[model samples]
Target: DAGVTQSPTHLIKTRGQQVTLRCSPKSGHDTVSWYQQALGQGPQFIFQYYEEEERQRGNFPDRFSGHQFPNYSSELNVNALLLGDSALYLCASSLALELRGYTFGSGTRLTVV
Candidate 1:
């Protein structure tokens, strides 16, 4: 089965706008995690979703939101985009939140103008 998959490999948005990023988990994964990677920096966790609920979150602002479906796919929604929000957003999937089995996608590169 395929690993995690993300949509719109790249996109550009204007400030104050909102964007929604999509993710599809691996065949057997039941959890999805999202992260943001700025230039020259490692990915910073945004949040994780399991059983359609937010299981955990990082230090990101409330402007960052997400939802997991019954089929294990997920979406990350960012509102009121700012220049600082321009970054690579990653999607990782794991079985039951196991870190060791995380399979990540290439990520969606979002550039806020």
Candidate 2:
């Protein structure tokens, strides 16, 4: 079975531009979540989507948003990107009823210059 997949493994954007990262969940998975990892820090939860609705969100600003489609695929969008926003964006997928573990994608590395 295929695992989570993220598009455009790497991206470069300006300080004020917007960026959208895409993710397709693993087979048989119904929940999708997003995280941000800086150079040295561990992944920080950005938000989670279940049943096509955002179920939980972290401390990120309003500029960060996400969407989960009926097919269980997802997208993460960041508006007015800042240099500080540069990080590895990870997508994780798991069955909502069986939340023992998650399968994560390699991640999309975003660079703001």
lDDT of 1: 0.95
Which stretch of 10 consecutive residues in model 2 shows the poorest summed lDDT?
Answer: 97-106
Q: What are the lDDT scores of the predictions, listed in order?
A: 0.95, 0.96
**After superposing candidate 1, which stretches have Cα over 4 Å from the reference?**
none
Write model 2 residue lDDT over 1-113, tens digit each, in one string: 66899998999999999999999999999999999999999999999999999999999999999999999999999999999999999999999997658999999999999
Deviation in Å, model 2, residue 75 alpha carbon = 0.2
Q: Write the per-residue lDDT of candidate 1 for residues 1-113, one digit (tens) a residue.
A: 77889998999999999999999998988999999999999999999999999989999999999999999999999999999999999999999847668899999999999
Q: Pick the candidate with the highest lDDT.
A: 2
TM-score of 1: 0.97
